[model samples]
Target: MRQSLRSPQQHCPARRQPLPVRNRVHRAWPVAGVAALAVITAGAFTTLAGLLVGPLHREFGWSRSTIGLASSVNMVLYGLTAPFAAALMDRFGMRRVVGTALALVAFGALWTTVMTAPWQFVLAWGVLVGAGCGSMALAFAATVTQRWFVRRRGLVTGVLTAAGVFGQFAFLPLLSRVVERFAWRTAALTLVVAVTVVLPLVLLLLRDHPADVGVRAYGAGEFTARPASAPGAARRTVRALLRSARTGPFWLLAATFAICGASTNGVMWTHFTPAAHDHGMPATVASSLLAMIGVFNVVGAVASGRLTDRFDPRRLLAAYFALRGLTLLALPLLMTATAGPPMVTFVVLFGLLDVATVPPTLALCRELYGGDSAIVFGWVGAAHQLGAGIAAFAGGAARDAFGSYDPLWVGVGALCGAGALLALTVVRPSRT
Candidate 1:
């Protein structure tokens, strides 16, 4: 079991020694960097997939739906990996779990460089990369906030979650250029190098618990013991999942998040460039637009965090879903052969709502799951990805079947409308 750090203030009055001023500085800030690195490393692959779709289709003669199946596997495994990873983090350590995940990401990328068949792509990108990325998903952010800090958790969660956007926007434009200039193998190699670069930082800088440094979480006035893990962590995961399955709140939260994942990762991230290409925009232009969206996502995600800290999370979530649905509804009408004012407006507005769902969703998890928030939230993440996986496959199939993406967009927008209503139904447990 991990040991807990005690604040100086919590020590016996007579035995207390002064805590060095620097020691009390929140260590979570640096830990957040490590967490962000993991997310960024995972996100690099996710952001680049859209650019790869058209190229893969042209070179391999694979249909868009065939390529999307790989993405579907990736999304499904990504979601399924989270809760198990959280349990492992509790049993092993952050450094071990994170390091292993990164290695898997690197290896998955390396394997993708040599793929000659669709099944190989599915195994590498879908199973391996998806599992690796899922291991470091928002659950890592949740783990960091819960274990490393007592105050400012919302703010940190927001920043860490925004790291996904940063990874996308910062890298997507450049990567689109890379794909334009080089073979897909070069792009796969780039992911290998990028994921490998963060491994050392994670190994050297990250600690599983603040107690490793002999200081309490920032603003904590007393020591709290880390809870012991169950003898069988896999069994524990099943139990927590079964218990959460029985709760009305869990189903409501999961349903909303499924819509969230379908909207963001499933349709938009996977198909946005191709969808734009359908209207005669270049892939590079679409990626740059996505990069722009990433910039605004930072602002929106951070503001959402602050709002969640002070406001009713359910209302914030409802507003976010409603606004997102409206923007998506407007998207079909705004499509033009080239970048224009309407497209620009959609990018800006949707960017602000992009990952804005994260902070409020996480806040609600804390309220709902209490002590098991991290692991329970992991299951919710799975539901989100399950939706993404289904949507990713279905969106591509729709494009193939109908020769247009319009139907997919309309269906997803309507689902978002349903999600907004569902968000309001989330019952907050009364505070004692």
Candidate 2:
């Protein structure tokens, strides 16, 4: 039998080879890495309010309700602004959108220093800071996770979401010390400086897409195409809302997130320090407890992300909400003048639940909505903020009316129970 010596060119056409992880022109992790740091800096404005509210009340002779109204406005704007921020990021690029947001945060923090009246506080903290921070909200984490990593989306989401925990945990003690030692103005100045510093970093390192650095998303075998530029952001937002409103899952997710925001940002982050004060704890000690929660939250959030990659997200969310509810029910008992085992245990448990909801929630959004995940999550985030804003105001009002945060805690715990039931009801799509 004649062995036919075919020319080498007669072989089947070469298959496209994936670029090696090391030899790839650009990597996704660097972009995600920079984003994580920028996110931490962006969050500086959020945690200080609990510490500042008391000082502002004392210095300006304002009511707790009045101070809380400003925080409410901030939360509302933070939620309301997210869809547009997502839109802006889609159309204009991440660097420009985030850069502009940082500028707004700096201006607001700086402007807050000279505020002499309640209305000025509203304008600076409520309007400016709210809008600025909202523009850089958790949607950024979702956006980056979806765009940068195919293999570790859940884990990355967890880490990025933990950035918020880092901001609150790492900074609250320091900010409380600053407020106690100097004027509240000094604390505001610190926020301005921090945001200003992050601005240069965003410009220098952040890119809108992996292609901008010449590589595919991590684990993907090829480059993905850029999405079409968004239409008028306001118009797109309205349209997306209208379309998403027709779905049951959208409402379910939104409702659950609202509870999340109400429980965490609205009630706890905004009032926990003062509530602890009611039980005889000093501001420093209260802030330390909150900071400790943040530390554990980092662990919980990261772990949740890895879990989300492996388990049913809906189940994880249900368990997280139920656990959080139990913790909230126990919180009042632990509120004491001196730090003790009970309080320490509460901090650890609650911190693990804090922001751990984010990874599973985002994973579900991405799985369900595909390309629209960022915007859908943005609207859901709006619900979260709305709940947070309302809770902030309502908690203050409740405290004023009853002279205790007991009612607020009980009410939020009930809401968490409802959220757990809702999370379990979500119609999960089969994982591919």
Candidate 3:
């Protein structure tokens, strides 16, 4: 009996198995799809702020500056919240953090519909939505790609970044019409419904790590255990910032990204519709043009991602920034009361350039910082928002003071030129 038992034990199978077949679709893709959807939803809220400017000003007799102040607050908090959100993902898990963010966004949208005062608007739109969207910002994309993918990281990052901008600009035409035909409250309510629908999907489908699903990250050669959740999310975030701050690349990335924010999110996203309206285009037409930009942004960002995988990301950054600057400089000449050929040309080119910088920037962060890339990129993103907040307010103030957005465009264009030069100066970290 003992001899028979020994024989059976010796014949038992080994515990480990070969890595799963590559032919099968990885779970990462589906997770990425959900992440993209979440980002798109968050982006819709970000761009929705621009649309509210006109309606609020008209309805409440608030000045453009006052509306812009709320936008500035939103943009600032949106950026400031990213690093913490990233760290929170590490501590709490992506599913929980993201779901909470969606909830906050939904609540903020609902609150906006009922607010009567400027402070109330700022509290609802600025603080809550900003924090919510910030948590879902590009850093969220970076975290997902890094954690769930070991291949095609750049491509995935580009797609997610594009999703955000696509969400922002794509819905503008419909939302603008809603505001024009019905009321701004109707538009806010619409956002609440959209966000609420996405929340449950996220809670159900989104997983914290690849290991959670009995798989490794897509393209990983072998399975590895998920890292232990670090204690103190806030402490980790601060420590990451402190360590990264010592590096020259961090500052350069932050500065360039700030300009990126100022030019794109600040001046363009926030003020373009109002500026176009000022020049003679109807709100719906202006929004349609913006929507076209959103469509092409997907193309540009994805193409840039593919390129980043193959080329030197630094060079790509230089080219993208320089071209963006030139395009912004030409905007005043191209923008007219009507959607002329010149304006359309500007829209096509600008849309293509809009968020293309993100993939390369994220790649640079990964290349330079390795494991700390997500947190570092979060800080860089905060700078982007800082620039955006300043530009959003400045653009509004400039409009109120000077009666035109032309000067603001010219100023931001010049800054983009500086950003191009700054991109070239980022030094690659030495691999020991």
| Predicted structure with the largest lDDT when compared to the true one | 3
Worst 10 residues of 2 by lDDT: 12-21
- For candidate 2, write residues 270-356 as lDDT tens digits: 999999999989999999998898889899999999999999999999999999999999888778799999889888999999999
Ten contiguous residues with the weakest lDDT in model 1 = 1-10
Model 3 Cα shift for residue 236 (angstroms): 0.6
lDDT of each: 0.87, 0.88, 0.92
Displacement of residue 48 (Cα, Å) in model 3 is 1.0
Per-prediction count of colliding residue pairs?
Answer: 0, 0, 0
Ordered list by TM-score, greatest first? 3, 1, 2
Ranking by lDDT: 3, 2, 1
Q: Please, what are the lDDT tens digits per residue for candidate 3 over residues 270-383?
A: 999999989888989999999999999999999999999999888999999999999999999887889989989999999999999999999999998888899999999999
* TM-scores for the candidates: 0.94, 0.93, 0.94
Error of 3 at 269 (Å): 1.0
Worst 10 residues of 3 by lDDT: 14-23
The TM-score leader among the candidates is 3
Question: What's the lDDT of the predicted structure labeled candidate 3?
Answer: 0.92
Across 284-369, the per-residue lDDT of candidate 1 in tens digits comes to: 89889999898888899899999999999999988999999989988889887888999999999999998999999989989988
